[model samples]
Target: MRRLLSAVAMLILLTSACGEDTLAAGTYDGPLAAEGRQGAAHRVVECDDAPTGGNNYPGEYDNGALSDEPEAALRTAFDEAQITGVHDGYVLVREDDDRALFTFTDAGRVRQALIVHDGEAFGKEGWYVESWARCDYAELPAAVAERAGVEIWFDADGPVSTRRVHSADGPEHCGWQHLTFLSLGETTYVRDADTEYAEWTDAPYDSEADLPPHAVDTGFHRDGDHLWRSPDGTRAYVGNREKVAVWPRTKDGFTCA
Candidate 1:
């Protein structure tokens, strides 16, 4: 499944360059890519089924009141399960009598979906995480999106606007190479991905000088991050306020030759 998802992501990355020009350019049909090294990071673990050491709150509450204060309810539920690191910036995506979906970006700029459901567990009625996952640039699954009542824009290739900096050297460990930087407003998402490893970093700069010393130039001239590119576009000298970083493009995903 991992290999298949990687292959699918590659195919999407290849064909998504067409954008809206192609028939299926703007659609995405796949489960939320499980994050983390274990590949089970997104699995939903019921709080009641597991031992919460008395963290699980077993009580009766008004459904309408709980729905009105979703965040508060979720906080109580998360506390019951000892779930931490989720707070603020909660956008209610979907809410029904049985369940509600909220989306938020953590401090690392990784988007996450939190599902709180109203059901009876251990003879108590409350809200708890049905499931949650790290959603970087991919769209939510069809069923999830449908419940959210929003149209998610999915490009087969990847993010619509991004600057890709190919590693000067070929695959390092586990065929990891390219660095894709996506800037959305004030937030910049730096993603490192390959056949095996995938990681994201939030590196937002206030100005050119604020950018890190080794920051790769994404060819956005207006942003003051300039790159002196070779005539063939294989080599580049990325300039910043203090120093310049150089990268020689690789060919065939392995060699600089």
Candidate 2:
């Protein structure tokens, strides 16, 4: 009985250590916020879509390819780039002279990866999306329009739940941030704060930040496609061309848990 209990205790200890190793510090991709950037690794290739020669800073770039086995690519790239000490949620991959942060799922799949520009740290603004290549072990996956029982379409048109504002408030025509994506029945909408941040601030309604947090709940007109403050109000995307903004549910909606 004593030997059996010892064996069980050893198994439990191994499991706990494995779990701790897999999960990094933070909840989502924000791991480095607490742990800080690691060693002297740097990025070599730019992660942008447009092609550039070498070692340039402050230019527009495109997002990288979605991968099921992004962790594998990080390892292979590490041989040349030397990325080390990756937590399960996020990893910093460094080239000889450049660095990028790769955010992964708990399962170790790649969610998104971005290049941190020169002079910028891991968590700040200069992180441009990386250019991902399809590996033999995993192919770049498609952007899911629907997940967790919710349907989503971009640049879509038709009668979506909407409301409007007087010119004094906003563009005079904005959908209730939540209604921008046409949903049905009990399907709930969730926002990935890292990806869809404009939903939380008034910055989108007025890029100049001139408005005083005005509410648009009056005029009503629905003509074409639309863009509204993302459900949170972080940034503004294009929304309906109608008059009134009709909110189907409550505003101050839920952010992804």
Candidate 3:
């Protein structure tokens, strides 16, 4: 919990891995793809406005059924420096971290956690948006806002339905490449048994590959190598990490089995 990065940066991330065609064959335009499809994660967002989800916390499976399954849709994608460097001209800058922490238990469904900084004018970028659970925090798409290149404020549509995610810090569960969290719904996946990936071309690159299902699954959990549940296990994406990324129920989207 306090090792952050070492061993020669984990041997330069196992001699560098996570090759999705070197960050998904880049391309973006028009207001940075309209802030990569409506950018957000939080900006003084405070919602307890009272939706009051049913009090059946006991195996609470009535109607919502893992909250409109699809592995529990929640999405955001972008990488290649905020889609070709700050909307093509660079003016991007995200700031907000008053000690980032936005949990969900009163029916927010484990969402929004920040530590942002996606700058511009000349150059600036930094990230840390752990658990960006989204039900639709205002639009969101554009490759799920560049997979965490940085700059977000989506609240995931107020009161999250099933599962959602947003964590950053690749390399160390298998060095490099891993930042697409929307565990179950609206397409957000990457967990072929804790992703020991070394290949999967059509984007995301460096070299070596073999794990591609794209997005969607509804049940997964593993704990020793930290690959938490909630794609449809009811909230708990990527526990303590040893290998985490989900979407494995049996059937869903992202095209895997």
Evaluate residue 20 in candidate 3 and report its C-alpha lDDT on the 0 to 100 scale: 23
The best-first sequence of candidates by lDDT reads 1, 2, 3
- For residues 1-257, write the lDDT of model 3, one tens digit per residue: 11122212221111113222212211112121112111333322233321211111112212211112111111111221111111111111221321122222112232222222222211322222222223232222333335434223224243232234333333344444443333343434343323333233112221222223332232332223233344244322343332333333322433332
- If both were scored by TM-score, which would come out higher, candidate 1 or candidate 2? 1
Q: Each model's TM-score? A: 0.27, 0.22, 0.19
Candidates arranged by TM-score, highest first? 1, 2, 3
RMSD to truth, every model = 17.9, 17.9, 21.0
Kindly give the number of clashing pairs for every candidate: 3, 36, 47
- Which ranges of candidate 2 are over 4 A from the true structure? 1-58, 61-88, 119-173, 178-180, 183-257
Q: Judged by TM-score relative to the true structure, which candidate is superior, 1 or 3?
A: 1
- lDDT against true structure, model 1: 0.35
| C-alpha lDDT of all candidate models, in order | 0.35, 0.27, 0.26
Best by lDDT: 1
